[model samples]
Target chain A: MNLGGRHAVSTLNDIIEIPIDAEGDIVRARGTGRDICRTLGFAEINQVKVATAISELARNIHQYAGKGRITLKVLGAPRPGIEIVANDEGPGISDTKLVLSGTYRSRTGMGKGLLGARRLMDYFELVSAPGKGTHVTLRKFVR
Target chain B: MAAIANFEPAATRLARFAALRRALSQAESVDAIAEHTLAFVQTALGVRSAALYASTREDEDFALIASAGDADLPPSLDRTSPFIVELGASKGDLSKTRELGSMWGVDRAIPAWQGDNLVGVLFVTGELELEIVDELQFELERALTVSIVAMLREEELAVLAIQERELVGLLREVQERDALMRADLEKARDFQRQMLGAVPRVAGAEVAVTFEPLELVGGDLYAVAALDGLLRVFVADATGHGVRACLTTMFIKSEYEIVRSSAAAPSSLLAQLNDAIAKKYQSAEMLFSAVCADIDLATGATRLAFAGHPPACVVRAGAAAMIGGGGPLMGLRPRMRFELVELHLDTDDGLYLFTDGFVEARATSGEQFGDDRARDAIEAAHRAHADVGAALKSASEAFVGGAKASDDATVVSVRRVSPEEQAPPSLAPASAR
Candidate 1:
């Protein structure tokens, strides 16, 4: 849970690691993410859902933050869940609480993308500071 | 017995009390009253010196009000000092005294109170019997209690009055600036309306345009330029709403006009326009989506070029198909290439072009009136023999019901009028398809 730097955040079991710097990278991340979801035995519908969630996060990085990293992880053994962690070193969000509650939207970015990603995932956690950075974690069960 | 003899007389004491009350009541302000109180105490008690110190607004420290000759007042009087503590606890008592060297020295401290609130301390230094000192304390306490309370009240009101005047001035300034901005926006809106151009009534085509800009002003533009017996249509919408976006549309209209003579083909025209925008506004953060199409009047042949805009619906022969466009948004990069899609338009076929606001418009349930719905609307409008712009608008309004539009909506419908409708069958030119 406490992944300090960019390298430590992604586990060795990460299915795919994408460096999103342009709009095309989002499309690439979405395609590769659905494949990983399919390999984890997620149903077709769930794979599309997981892929769509990855697309929004990746696109947000390309649009507002300019560049960031997205790591797709599939956990095993005791439990199985697809996790996506997006880290950005751009201008960080100051009010994570308001953003999560769906009350505030950034001037440049639409209010729907983050909330839409949260809706697709079974678990959502966000850690951010004004000038430091933003780290988002999303997970969906393999049902 | 010695203290009793120092007292002036019962009548004189009564007269002095009444005079003190009269002088305080007539005082105009806090500082004026403090000045009067200090002067009265020195002359009535015949003291060598006197001073008055009171708490400031924050009650953190006491500020000296008025002082006369060798008063020996402290530079700062903290509210937490023991002298202030005793004054607050006992309410009004002059029994307390601190030893500082004095000239005519029976130095006494008196507390001034207003309805149980301790306002300040009064200090007097003089040579007097205990009885005269007690009498003087009673008179000074009575005088200052009335004056200090009135002084604090008047001082508070004075500060508030000054702040109110300043606030009113600031509000007026803001209102004036807002009026000027609104006037500028109105003028800009009028200029943009002129750029939409009159409804085109060419010999072989029927063109109708619908434009609705949000009060905040969004960039939605349509230009119909005729060249070499061909009609060139250009439509563009900029990102975000407001004055900045509206200005971009002006630039697009002017650039389209300037390049008309140099660029003959649809693709070349779009490419030239993109280069002009990208070069001039490289740092403006203004991006736009546009589509350019030239329709030959004689052959009904059309060539379309696009720049990151929505697909245009080609409705012909009772079926509808969307022509997809692929290119980067204009103003983002220099030398961007737009691919030209060539299509043969049959007589009476309609080409519907619109901004994303039409499809992205949300219904009451938060569902977007999507591309499929737009395609369906266009097909229905083509069948109904009604205005395509009106049909699409009514359909979207019905879909959204009463929901407010989040962005400005625009539509341009160009239907190649059949040759039979223009004139008598024999009079129709051989060049008409």
Candidate 2:
């Protein structure tokens, strides 16, 4: 559901809103995503992958942005997959190109979360610039 | 109905009062008192109804307790009313009351007292009268008053016993819950200790590490990588306490391993560690202070970096010099740059990579075992050529004077083993596990 003038993929009832502010909210965000994925007939392995991706994105927004939200939309008909979006007003990635090119892994110890999330899902789109904010949209088709 | 005249015979009046006492002697409750008093009033003075009013507690005013006969008597006695004020002023003398009982449709009321406090009152509707029997009337009131006080004392004791039982039950519940929680914590502490793995033996150096968590589980962690020719030491202190902080350490340990062997520089390893936490928990306010030092065995070159962590030291000839490479904390952001401290140590020198918990330990006099004292303790050990871990730990304990540790402390000593001091190749690194 579109809370504002943003893209409206599903109605209010079909969208699950998880606001990530504290540590516990990150778990809740992924748990909700996993449950929805399972109900949509996702395979057990896919369920785990989806859940891990949700955790990565939610944790990203929570730790770096300080505040953000994750919305999961259950796609229907032509495409049956869960569409997840993470939105935040924190310091956005200045080099979006480098982040996806696998070089942004000057990270904790290994793979950058964005790169990992990108590989897990079928469709991934990231939009951002310095000082503006980061918006990530991801979808993995059941087919 | 039987009536006693104003000038009834003294013997007759005395006999009636004695009989009333005998009737109420077996009464146990307020209801029994009402029943016996009403019967006595009906047979002796021919009253139509009688009701008993009593205060439910010591602080309460009189309220309806029991009633018998015609039952049209006053329901209760309000302590604040003028009628009660005058009745209280009359003390136990019913003769001094000027018909105040008429306010609530009662002909006469008898006050029951336990010392100065009014425990109960007996109101009669139709008391046709014995005018003044003096001592006999006073004797009748005292008989009822004694029974009322005894009933109240028994009720209070019953309530106290019930409350005590409930208190015991709640205490047991709390103790059981505490025991379960402690068991779970013990399991977590054991898992954390197991995950620490081994204190690796570097091909060119001697390594000794001592770790102590303040609680059953803590955030301090250390992992030694001596798999390849290069020896990398990673130590991290997550920014919290207990299980949550321990979980952070676990995450860091796993992520650090993923990139530890392949990292180009010690600074790059820390950067990758930062990216792992920053990208994963970027939305959370989670952070950790860490120090990573990688030493080249062939060249004796060391690259050490600190991220919101305390500085490490280089020991040369019984002296220590502090080296700081302060940088931003890990997590809560992405792509953070960490500064590096480059140093070199040969066969005669060593290095100490430790957490702030050691220096921040406090004594009974509120004195801190600060940087200066820490360096002094390390130098003292170096001069004597004693075991660094044992000497430093004992020095800290002595300075703390038995005070509890406020945080987790980890000290790792790395020194080159001279060609003469190197252990035999048959003495494997697996033994350190």
Candidate 3:
């Protein structure tokens, strides 16, 4: 079911929507991302990069948010690339800048989770508050 | 004139004998032959009562299959009984002991033999046994009695064959189901091994790990990370077993890696891990136990924390002592705080961390390998200058006495090497870059 608010976006033919609810769903969401990347003629290494990025995002929704939805789209106007959006209504991050800035308590953690996913995509956008939940949009172009 | 009278009776007897043979040869089942055979014996033999006994391969005795006219005979006769022996030893139809007839309450019992195997017996009371069968009108009836016994054996084999087929089908079905279950476990094991991280290499400290996974994939995991000047060892035991438990271990590994380098202390890292697991599967099945330790390689100063995990051993030269503060199980609630304790490890001193699987393992005699034994094993290993990891693993295995562990187990020990044992640094600054 579509939540259909500001988070909604028009997509082309290769749009696939999957709900991330459990731990197993993370693997499925990652697999679907890899398949679409391969179909679009992306290099093998870049395809792995995209799939690994999706794993971290899906893991957050499964671990922190408890439930969420992931939307995958093949972007045609964006130079034949892939666009993924992860939306969740669970407790959102209070501060997104510090995590992205990479000055986090980076000793024991893996670059604050979002910082790793952001590096894999050409375009990254994050919107959240303490209570408003989180929505992230990631895009990677063939070029 | 008397010879002509005898020829007339002999001709009549031959016609009667032919009729009896025709009737008995048509008996399809043993039950079908019972009434007809009894009627023939009672009337043609001039006997008051008659009974039939049949023996099958499964039976050790001839059982009274059918009886008519209430002949007083035993319900069954053992194969070795004197009554059956004497009857089997008879020439053809009647028991050899004609004078012993009243003892069996039967004048005669005609034995049916197929190649020396006693197949059946037909017993009759009244005047028939006392008369000589060759002189009597029913003399030719002996041949018909053998046909009834032959039919009984054939019917028994047919019943047994059908039962054997059904048993074979049931055995095959069970074997197929077992094969499927084994395949599932193997796949899960491969997945677990793939996601597991390697043990950490702490400088100046000798690190040894002991791990015991169950027959099926289990949730025990050891994740090590070398961060800055400390080696962070995260040992965890997730709840439950099987594929789901294996998946949870992977999830725990990923979460720990993400927060490990950023975490300020052992307690903070545990709190973050607890938050991640608790926030997910809110169900009780998601609970787990863990010990997080950050060892300072230079000073051998260790910061330790436990979340429902057993205490780690601080084994010095004299003896072993356990050190860890109280904490609740992870995944029960979010944002729960984990307490930490600080301990200093001198050179040659061993710091041992283990899951409950080590201390709670039971012997065949139902005795648990409690904390005291674990202390002794770790202490003895260090005092003997032995490999502490192998010592702990073998000690627990010997305690369980070759029984498969009921739960998964993991042990990690990092001891600061004494100055005499430490190797040279073996590295230069790469010609000053």
TM-score of each: 0.53, 0.58, 0.50
DockQ of predicted candidate 1 = 0.01
Please give the lDDT score at residue B66 for candidate 1. Answer: 78
Q: Please count the clashing residue pairs in each candidate, in the order shown.
A: 0, 21, 16
lDDT measured at residue B305 in model 1 versus the true structure, 0 to 100: 90
lDDT of 1 by residue, A16-116 (tens): 57888888788777777777777788989788778777877887788768999898887776768788999999787787644543434456544346666
Q: Point to the candidate with the largest TM-score.
A: 2
* lDDT digits (tens) for residues B1-433 of candidate 1: 7545545563365367667646755654445556777666666557787777764233336667777878656765778876666656764333445332222153766655555666656677775555555554555456555554444444344334434544696699899999999998888776777666576567787777878776646688788767777988888888876787888777787887888778888889889988988898777576899888899988989999989999999988867788966578888988878898999888878888888877788988999888888889998888776777777777888899899888877888888877568743343321110
Residue B148 in model 3: lDDT: 38
Kindly list the per-residue Cα lDDT of model 3 for residues B1-433, writing each as its tens digit: 9776756665665367656545654654344455666666665555678777766332347868688776677788888888777766665544363534555777766665556666666666765422334433132233334443443333333224333543585589788888888888788776676556445445667676776676567888887667667878888888876667777888788888888888889999999988987898688877788999988877788898899988889987657998883589988999999998998877777888888777888887888888888889989987886767678778988888977677777777777785457766543211100
lDDT digits (tens) for residues A39-106 of candidate 2? 88899878876877787788788778999999998999898999999999999988774455443345
- CA-lDDT, candidates in order: 0.72, 0.73, 0.71
**Order of models, best TM-score first:** 2, 1, 3
Q: What is the lDDT for B211 in model 2? A: 80
Candidate 2 docking DockQ: 0.01
**lDDT measured at residue A51 in model 3 versus the true structure, 0 to 100:** 80
lDDT-better candidate, 1 vs 2: 2
Restricted to chain B, the TM-score per model reads 0.66, 0.73, 0.64
